[model samples]
Target chain A: MSEDEIEAAAGASVDPDARHAEKMRKKKAVRDKILATKTVEKGLIIVHTGKGKGKSTAAFGMVFRSLGYGLPVAVIQFVKGAWETGERFALERFGDLVSINAMGEGFTWETQDRQRDIAAARRAFETAKDLIRAGEHHLVLLDELNIVLRYDYLPLQEVLNFLTTEKPPHVHVVITGRNAPDGLIEIADLVTEMEMIKHPFRSGVKAQKGIEF
Target chain B: MSEDEIEAAAGASVDPDARHAEKMRKKKAVRDKILATKTVEKGLIIVHTGKGKGKSTAAFGMVFRSLGYGLPVAVIQFVKGAWETGERFALERFGDLVSINAMGEGFTWETQDRQRDIAAARRAFETAKDLIRAGEHHLVLLDELNIVLRYDYLPLQEVLNFLTTEKPPHVHVVITGRNAPDGLIEIADLVTEMEMIKHPFRSGVKAQKGIEF
Candidate 1:
């Protein structure tokens, strides 16, 4: 039956299966139209940044989702390597499909050494560039790379040059952290800014193990 | 040796293990302090809202993370029930640990009837309240509940009242959608507004199966 006709029929019936079937039939048409229009397929440079939480969490989520598709994914941590995270622990079960390298000394304030921080950032950036150029991994997550860029620990232009020029055409890269550089935003295929409307931390709630980390 | 002494010793070392150990020692102190002061462990009302794309994705990530900790999680999808989603497909392997119920007929635009939309929203909300009150699940994700609240299909005040008063104190609830009501925001323990800086959809890229769904 036509989707419209089925939907009209569904309006009178109380059966959920009939209603759901009709709804799906109609949705399929709209979704098919969208699918037809979107023909371009290329590796995306996705950036997650802003004042709210979930930037890194969302990036990790994407990594988890990509793994479901059997994609080889690498995570290179920039500023959160110092602390053990639940994601690192959870992702360990994936075996060889995921390669996580926690390279950062710590956050800038936590490290409290400009020269040392710069050296760490440079090493992390080099590792990131290698991962991107290797092309073995379909997705490479540069977790907290934005923090290094925001703090000028790594040269913005140099980072931009590598992203724009050296990144493999087929490698999907995700850069996550607050205060993303403008240059990176301009070139990114997708940029999500997590705005902080309310945080439990402000109300004296500490970060929980599975929820925050 | 004290954590301070170990950190001092590691300052001059090139060994990564030494540095990481030292950093962890210092971080442990700070984290311990935060943990010591945070004794309250109640159910959290988390709202992920805004124009960005990761609201539901992040919530799903939380579900994924929660599952890693062996917590029972349920996802009540309000407006996305008609189509199959990657998360729904992937989460199926967890067996009964994850309960994903896509209850809505469809989005308001697709459903195109106020009475039908209201009925659907009411049914979904009842299911959500049942899940929340049952307390079988550690986390209950009310996906796209904000859309129902936004369109006034469900009264905002009653939703707020239920969330605040009727919800089990230990059941963490996550609501995801755009235009979260201010009352909901005020009552939420954590609120993240996903701001869309740039989207590939705007650039004519189709939503890929694994990435968008």
Candidate 2:
């Protein structure tokens, strides 16, 4: 017996399998149409910001991916300082393909000096500018830059101008931190805001070495 | 002149710098107190979910971090299949430190057969169970397992039972996909929902080599 006839004899109103297949066929056609229209290829100004974690981790994931292709990448930690992180240690194995410069003194509360914080931010931004202008790296990550920008340690206008006008067309930039500025969000090609639904910290779980760092 | 006296003479009601310093000092004390209470250490059930990018990317980030420490890790791709992704390629360089199993035939739409999809999921879950029970790997990433569970391809209770009862301690499990089950989220230690604020696909920009894949 045919599948539809068997289903009808089995007291089913319709052949669910055939119906689902037909539905998926239409969906695939729509998806193909949309995907075919997307042909543009260029470096994206990607932003990862929110209260949750993985802002820098996701950026580092991209860095590792870039390194896999033997692509040059630069990482400028604007506010994390030069702590020995698991990612840092791992990326170091890549040798000359990756350059990670943790330029911040520490968190603002840890520093507690606005002038010193501003100076550090300025220095980091200078490094970022040099890297982006040189276009030597395929991917440049401004880690925790949104934190610096949120605190007004660096001039937002100057940073925006540099990113929009001075950055090379082929250099992909990933800016990550909480409280991304509206101006930065406006110009970003892609943005993902990670929302913290539940955290182990709330249950008195300390951050592990390899996991958190 | 004393700093406070100079500020007073300059018509400032209070020394802003001194007040700021005092405020930060108090904040630090509170933070330290909370941090001191957190001493628990164990494997974490981390969930990366929601309708945004980076669910799998962030999981892969943790995988890379784990590999950096020379930890054994296994990645079971439930829906992605054996595509030539940048992460897969990059992770391959880790050799025996990492094992990536792309067991899915494809998405449900691509397969267009519910029974086949269910069989594939069952097989993949069996592999996951074996890995978790063996406790051989320090980290196990069930990439897109949520997609399988969401479709009811595998029994959720069975999966939950295995995770809670059968899995060995000290094996950190990272589950990635959208619409993670409430039961899984309830048992998870850390859950971050990646919210899509904007996407380049809307602007006709296709996924790039290193950035997306």
Candidate 3:
């Protein structure tokens, strides 16, 4: 419709409010149409990767949301060592509903042992495979699994095969880390790259407890 | 140092493992020095903005993390209406420790009432100001307040002034949404832009319960 016709259809006046309302009415109609077309539902392969922070934090948020529904969740930390973190302590309050396994010795640089890192990654992957195969949990978070894959600690093809073929249809898998592989991204239903605009660390701010951890 | 000298310092032999360990040690020393210099401790202004998902999800993760620390948190959602969400249900389990106020009627497109939208924004901001002023909560999340500011429903200068000058020193404030104001970004200690690489919505997947909500 022409501008004048659209305005008249919204209202018989030149009021801006009426024009905006009419514009929104058209937009909502389009949105509702799109919403109607989206009908597929199943567990998703979600990937969070980039240099910026919050990759794992967002995944943890999903875990928390899932817990609200009394759903079981398994968190497998592949890079961070077994250490006390605020999220870990908080999630532990849910008891058996939450399972967190910090499998890595530490960062690769900290360990500086390729063989040892590979061993740790393999062990973590084994635990993850068991959890996914059992299909007891609603969500399984593979925290930092991409880092291990990037370093070639675990075979990428093998991991992808299991996820695509063996993962239960009802289980949602969230994989988080920097530098997620192309294959993983291609298979992931949703992928978000947290781009760092500004970080406090660059301003000499240390990672604060309850914030960074 | 020369390449040969650097290699000799790491290890006399040309073993990759030894060289890697030595390189890590040097890196550790530098990292330690930087950590030592970052002795400042104070609450931060965190901003998560971009077109991708997980902006509020990350903030809610922080809330969950804070709850783990037994910290009080207040969540003020400015754009989303008071609706049943998994995260809201999850947080309500924390009882008095969590206070959520879903003040917006809905998105501006849905409401199509600028005056009413402004009123809602004002009321929400008033509640936010009160929570921040009380200084009782460890973290206060202004979820989607950026959208209000972006639409000019609330005075950006007034909000920035309060955040900069009147906000309690001990309370961390997290503001999330797309198109965050430049002034807010200038004052924020940490800012992350969630860049969308792939979204399932484009692939005809509906927003699933316990995942999108």
Interface RMSD values for all candidates: 5.4, 1.5, 1.5
Error of 1 at A58 (Å): 1.3
Q: Report the C-alpha lDDT of model 3 over A28-128, residue by residue, as the tens digit.
A: 88988999999999899999999887898889888988888888999999987422577887788789998888899898777878788899999999999
lDDT for each candidate structure? 0.80, 0.86, 0.88
Write candidate 1's Cα lDDT for B1-213 as tens digits.
987678668664546645554665677778667768776667789999998978887887787777777778998988954235556655775678888788888766565565777788899899999999899998899999998888778989999999889998888899999999899999999999999989887778766645665
A56-148: candidate 2 lDDT, tens digit per residue = 888888888888888999999898642356787678778999988889988877877777878999999999999999999999999999989
Best by TM-score: 3
State the displacement of the C-alpha of residue A197, model 1, in Å, after optimal TM-score superposition: 0.9
Model 3 global lDDT (CA atoms, 0 to 1): 0.88
Off by over 4 Å in 3: A1-13, A81-83, B1-13, B81-83
Alpha carbon lDDT at B213, candidate 1: 53
Chain A TM-scores, per candidate, are: 0.85, 0.90, 0.92
Give the Å error, residue B81, model 1. Answer: 5.7
Tens digits of lDDT, candidate 3, B1-213:
999899679656577666667676777788778889887767899999999889988898899888888899999999874225778878887789899989988988898887888899999999999999999999999999998998888989999999999998888999999999899999999999999999999989998776787
- Show the colliding residue pairs in model 1: none
Task: Compose the digit string of candidate 2's lDDT tens values, residues B100-173.
Answer: 88889898777777778889999999999898889999889999999999989999989888888887878899
Q: Candidate 1 residues A1-213, lDDT tens each?
A: 988689678665446645554665677688777868887777889999998878877776777777767678999989865235556655775779898888888766566566787898899888888888999988898988988887778889999899899888878899888888889999999999999989887667766655775
Model 2 CA deviation exceeding 4 Å by range: A1-13, A81-83, B1-17, B81-83
If chain B of candidate 2 is superposed on the true chain B, what is its TM-score?
A: 0.89
| Chain B, candidate 3: TM-score | 0.92
Please give the RMSD of candidate 1 to the true structure. 8.5
